[model samples]
Target: MAEEEKTDRIEKRRRQSPKGEERRAEILAAALRRFAEDGYQNAAIGDIARDVGLSLPGLLHHFPTKVDLLLAILAKQDIDSADFIGHFRSDLRSLLKGMVDIFRRNAGMIEVVRAFAILNAESLMKDHPAKTWFLNRTARMQNDIAVTFERAIAEGSIDGGVDAMAMAAELIAMMDGLQMLWLRQPDRFDMVGGLEAYVNRLLTSLGLEH
Candidate 1:
């Protein structure tokens, strides 16, 4: 009887596992699609739940609030960003290559770029749950790039006299601007091409062999 009970428990757990993971992925996909198409302010939590064939209460059980889901989505993107940055260090060329690879590797992320850009632009609203989080997160990314810049300059791979902070700002601004432009002309913007061009231009201006 004990063995039979153990087997029953195992079967029950096994039956739940795939369904749970499937539901989680379904929720994420629905959120991504809605966020991409309708902007954050316009997306309804119920709609996301409906997209996944979940009741509103069921979705709430997984993510207590809409902001929670948004934060989770951003967190996932942050992990991807960190991985790419980790794989490519202080080299300007590697940085450029990494960005290209990331854009291609997660093409679906471009959808994310749409609504995120809209929200980021209005991030000055103090009540915005994302404002503080986004600000601190971006600051950290800039700090990482600044550190990389410092190392590259010290190693003579990149030129001296460049302010790491300023360079980091410029790089971020360049990428953000390109993303904005890409949304308007997704078919023609060539996201990778623009990033590579900007990096090459910056390197060339600094007298680097990039």
Candidate 2:
């Protein structure tokens, strides 16, 4: 009888663990939409809790604070972004395709994209909660992309004399600028198509593609 009770308890705990994780994920998703639609400054922790059908303390039990929630969201995005590039690390052609794919994915989650853009811009204020996160992310991205460009050069797919870091900066600038423009005129803009076309032109200029 005691062994059976222990086994049942362990089974119940295993089930509850996934349920708790799912609930936390549901909260994060709701918080994401709230932050995206209402800006971080405007989206209070109480509001997020309400949106997720949780009490303030219940929500806090999962995410301690609004800053904690925001960082969690950004951390997820950072991992996805890294995977986006990491998927095609060895293939230059695929790398370009991956960029388009990532942008298209972002377009599908336009609200989240909007949230990211707004938060990124706000982080430029220096005192923003995510300022260090953004700064560190940018530096890491630049270095990662620069290393990829160097690899392309070694493979003879990119011009040997080109400055990898400079090109990485330019690429990031173009993508961010295009996202801003696309957000303003989403219906009229073809962000993924435009990015694909630009990368094609860029590679052609570099003599990697015809």
Candidate 3:
């Protein structure tokens, strides 16, 4: 009887653990949708809680605060992106291709892409909780692209006259602008194709065969 009880208790804990994780994922998904549609400042925690079928206090028990939930969502986005790409390619042509591939993948996940577009723009506010997060993310992306460009330049694959940091900034800006336009009229924008064309032009300017 004692052994049976112990086995049942272990089984119960195993089931409850997955349930807890599933509920947390549900909360994050709901919070992401709310933040995407309303922006962080305008999105209410109560609405998020209701969306996940949890009371405010119950939601708080998981995330503690709205900012905590927002940060968690952002972290999850980073993890998902990293998982999708694995390590970024070091060669200029391959790296550029990877960027287009990422955009193509983003087209399939419109909700996640929309949330990122909305949240990134909203984080520009001085007092936004996610301001630092966006800033750091931008810096990291720029550094990655710049490093790849420098490597290509060193190997004579790209023009040594090209300013790596400047090009990195421009590429990031182009992608962000394209995302905003695409989000506004997704049916009309060929975001992936546009990016691929831009990359081909860049390679041509660098005297590299595509």
Weakest 10 consecutive residues, lDDT, candidate 3?
81-90
Taking all chains together, each candidate's TM-score versus the true structure is 0.87, 0.90, 0.92
Show where candidate 1 strays beyond 4 Å.
1-7, 106-108
Q: Output the better candidate (1/3) by TM-score.
A: 3
Per-residue alpha-carbon lDDT of model 3 for 133-154, expressed as tens digits?
8999899888888988898989
Tens digit of lDDT per residue, candidate 2, span 13-124? Answer: 9989999999888888988888877888788889888987899999999999989999899888887676666787676667766778788888888888888888888888
Best by lDDT: 3
- Of models 1 and 2, which has the larger lDDT? 2
lDDT of 1 by residue, 27-88 (tens): 97789789878877778999999998889999999899989888887787777666657677
| C-alpha RMSD for every candidate | 2.3, 2.1, 2.1
lDDT for each of the candidates?
A: 0.79, 0.85, 0.88
Q: State, as a TM-score between 0 and 1, how close model 3 is to the true structure.
A: 0.92
lDDT of 2: 0.85
